[model samples]
Target: MALTKKGEFWYGTTSGDTQAELRSYSVANEHEASRFAASKCDCGCRTFALQSDEDAGVAIRTCTDCGQEHLMGDSADHLDDAAPETHECVCENEVFELMSGVSVTPGTHDVRWYYIGCRCVECNLVAVFADWPCDAGDAAAFLAKV
Candidate 1:
């Protein structure tokens, strides 16, 4: 799977209805960003806001739609905004889970690396995420631990 998106993602609605389709979204304007930053839950029964990154731990919104409280994660590694040093495992058969936090260079603004727990769904191997080349079969050597 390739991680190919940047910035904050949110699910917005205009009916204040929990049944409304959770559209994949990002803040496109100042007004939208304000509403999102405020964690707006209902908009005259017209709109609702939810952060998509809330799951990966990168949200500042706290709107509870249908009794579910959505919050941003403080330990979240905001990789979407990170440099090209980090990338989503693009192998056709591998999937990755965002780990606890980001790996940054000590005393520097540079993000040296980011850790992602990866596994090859096809080969059933635990892949390592580092400076190594990105590939499915190429990482089999690191699978001995499993």
Candidate 2:
């Protein structure tokens, strides 16, 4: 399924009104993607905020209801010797909602490209934090694998 939400929000620093609007967009984006990669918190909440460190190939999802966090994507074993750093929005908020865009071949399940992004819960700034060329034959499995 494609993105089902739309509004007049930009993809950068946002005001209170635009922030809320973008959050709605993010929630919808997450829901659509769930058809491929379903996830839920222990609290039974399906909504979550997301964050990631591209260098570490790590993505984190935080439950919106109970504040629990889950790690997405692959392990950070490759970054065992890397320095630690913090990733936060300009608003100083570490919480965000995950959004993604995937391009699959027509009439087939193969995926050609994938882009994962984060929308700040505080300021609603949206950005594609990670993306890569893909040759996945199973779109759903690929999304889940990421």
Candidate with top TM-score is 2
lDDT by residue (tens digit), candidate 2, 1-146: 22223353344433333334334444554422222233456788755665555554555667878988665534234345334344566567866555554556667777655556555667665655454444546677656644
Best by lDDT: 2
What's the TM for model 1?
0.21
Which lDDT value does model 2 have at 28? 54
User: What's the lDDT of the predicted structure labeled candidate 2?
Assistant: 0.51
Ten contiguous residues minimizing lDDT sum, candidate 1: 29-38
lDDT of 1 at 42: 37
lDDT of 1 by residue, 1-146 (tens): 22222333212222221111111111111111111111223321211222233223233222223433323223234536433222233344322221111223344333322222233233322322322111212122212111
Q: What is the lDDT of residue 91 in candidate 1?
A: 42
